[model samples]
Target: MAYVVFVGGLVVVLAGLTWFASWAKRRGRGSGVAGALAAYEEAYRTTAHQSHHELRQQADRKSESGSPDDL
Candidate 1:
């Protein structure tokens, strides 16, 4: 039960981090975000490729069912 709450909190935090990164860039965070994004991209490099294909396959199943904030 506590683990589930922790995971949910983590998701929300990551979402906020994503939004903050985008906002920071707009306000000129520069290399600050570049490095972070590079690390982030590397972290998910393999999963991203697979997830890309999976998302494509699921595209027809639920047009409005998933979150588009997958960046």
Candidate 2:
């Protein structure tokens, strides 16, 4: 009984995924599996890891530079 319940839930989840894929195709982002994966990667990159350490270090160095500004 438990196995049957799990299989039923899996089927429902798969069906929903298929429906979404079909919709995505209509929107032109689901042409190929590779293309869909690429789009997802691009979207992820826009909000993913960023390297700001170099800029921070430059700012810190500018502030710490010895000049007339230093006592």
Q: Pick the lDDT winner.
A: 1
Clashing pairs in 1: none
Q: Give the per-residue lDDT digits (tens) of candidate 1, residues 1-71.
A: 99999999999999999999889879876666555655675577967656655664796575566568865
TM-score of each: 0.40, 0.41
| Runs of candidate 2 exceeding 4 Å displacement | 30-71
On residues 1-71, what C-alpha lDDT tens digit does candidate 2 reach at each position? 99999999999999999999889878877447754555675568643222233443575685546878677
Pairs of residues clashing in candidate 2: none
> Least accurate stretch of 10 residues (summed lDDT) in model 1?
33-42
Q: lDDT of each prediction vs. the true structure?
A: 0.74, 0.67
How high is the lDDT of residue 62 in model 2?
Answer: 50
Q: Which ten residues in a row have the lowest lDDT in candidate 2?
A: 47-56
